[model samples]
Target: MAFERNTQETYYESIIRQGYSRRDFMKFSTYIAAYMGLETSAIGQVAKSLETTHRIPVIWEHYQECTCCSESFIRSDHPIVADIILDKISLDYTLTLMAASGHQAEAAKHATMEKYKGEYILCVEGSVPMGDDGNYCCIAGRSAKDLLIEAAEGAKAIIAWGSCACNGCVQAAYPNPTQATPIDKIIKNKPIIKVPGCPPIGEVMAGIIVHLITFDRLPELDNIGRPKAFYAKRVHDSCYRRPYYDAGLFAETFDDQNAKEGYCLYKVGCKGPMTYNSCGTIRWNNGVSFPIQSGHGCIGCSEEDFWDNGPFYERMTGLAGFGIESSADTIGKVAAGVLAGGLAAHAIAANISKRKELRDSIRTARENEKKFES
Candidate 1:
């Protein structure tokens, strides 16, 4: 099933054609607006854009990847979000989801590129292997590098879907035999948005797309080119066990009493303090639970070179700009020590006051006895 190009179709039109009512369209608009961090007043603007703006053509290309990004995307919390974005709208070419394959799939891709030149969105999901002249990954006799160059040549903007396409992921870790390279390193000319994660949350992906469609521009990005709305804070900043972290209550092991009590996982190599993502807030599996919530430490999958940063189960030391000397343990220990010292000091002061009062009472009693004798 090749997606037929309909240049005149708006997103709202596609939604209605897909059997959704106006109310459903509005609901989707509201839902996306909230996810995008838009104000209440902007809900109407988002809806208006979907109602008036023509669906932008999208060409999703996959190279050396596990296809987890696509898997996470299709399983978005809202069924309509997947339906409207992946199927009903302008997703003209995607090898994973499109029905057409081989030459038919290639043809649809080329058609959209030619028809929507400098107008279509290019979504690259995997890294390109620069080793062996790009022989590591190929599709239909074309090298991954060659495919990416051709597809990116005319794109309005490029969206690098996961860590693989953003920071080279595990493929680029260590010796990197394949020399897997992220898209931004290859295509420096185009504006690229890096949604870096092992597999980014489904709603975050949808929010990014809707943001692009609604505003006809890119969302406000962080210093590293991620959407600031979703990546503004570290996972530790929002984790439910943050109080435990601040209070020096840490789980020393995976099955310790502290772990069972829901203490902070920092001592056991939780990377939440260093990892900037919305996992704690947006969560996964339809906002049910993220990795930390499921009793595992954050691996900092979203940060650059996270795989090589350290061992997954070993705690990081001397993190800069975090707490005292950039160590959460240090902060917690110091806080605990200060509290204990204050209590001890208070106790000693009270004991001295009691002794002084006793002395004064005895002296008064002796004076009374002398007065009575006189």
Candidate 2:
């Protein structure tokens, strides 16, 4: 019943006509629900959302970026990302993958803008160069700024993909000549979800898209416009070597026994404590591995100004430690000392507590025997 959509095809009827079965649609909905951190009861909402809501047309604009966001998106562990999102979710214009290009492709994008008019979703990758009155980057003889505003005017929402689009990444670093600017700095009127990373986690990218498709709304964003569900905690909170961190064990340097034994990378400049992301859990390369798991410290790619955060190989110094939250410096020694103290205390306290219970039971038994003797 959702109108002759922008594409002139209704939501449910369009996918069916495109060769997707109802079962495929249901599976995609369920998967998206989980990715969006929805409850089991919400799958119904998710299903209805997809079934009733027309696929939001996306105008994927690329500028001063390497297109790694799209690469990571398509390589997600889940097929739904590439299959449903990239191939099916109404991506009308993209420079890298679109078969149409030159004057024809530009015309198609213009047609969608006029036809959809405040209905399509705008996804921007890379930063816009603003120096020299935005003349640094141009498309089809129009400044990037002009193109962005033109496309955004017709968009229902905007998604800023990767640090390039969110924070300008390395392009906006100090002494920038072109004055690279993030999307948020230019687009102030609409809601923007910033998924920042060198290349965002593939599944996380998929999750964001799916949340939009399944809920027709943005996911719960944190102060930074990142989804709280995925960026809620530091990677340190979930690292496997966290026990080593708490116990104060460190590798000191790479190739040491501790490093080989999978000790915490805190000593090797891991930014896990300061970085918030799903890198430790969702991982990368089809969930096969992440930097930390591969024995490298987190570079905090998801964070702002990470390029200036410090040298990636230099560990953080002078952190607070208490309540078993010690760093990698003294964990082994402290754990040994604590174990020794507990062992001595447990030995002395064990027999007396057991004997007191035994004494009470024997007294009760003796009284019962006296009663029987009488």
Query: What TM-score do all the candidates reach, one by one?
Result: 0.84, 0.79
Once fitted onto the true fold, the runs of candidate 1 whose alpha carbons sit more than 4 angstroms away are 1-3, 317-374
Model 2 poorest 10 in a row by lDDT: 1-10
The local distance difference test score of each candidate is 0.91, 0.81
Candidate 2 Cα errors over 4 Å, as ranges: 1-24, 316-374
**Compared with the true structure, what per-residue lDDT tens digits does model 2 show for residues 1-374?**
11222554545566676677888777866776776677889888877866777677778999889999999988887665576567554678888777678887887788778878888889999999999988988989988888998988888999999999999889887667799999999999999999888898888888887788766788899987888878888888977778999998888798899999888888889998988888877789977888988999989888887776656877744333432345445666788899999999998788676998888899999999989954
Residues 1-374 of candidate 1 have per-residue lDDT tens digits of: 45575769888888898899999898988988988888999999999999999988899999989999999999998878889888667688998888789999998999889988999999999999999999999998999999999999999999999999999999999779999999999998999999999899999999999999899999999887999999999999999889999999999999989999999999899999999999988899988999999999999999988987767888865554564334667878989999999999999998887998878999999999989954
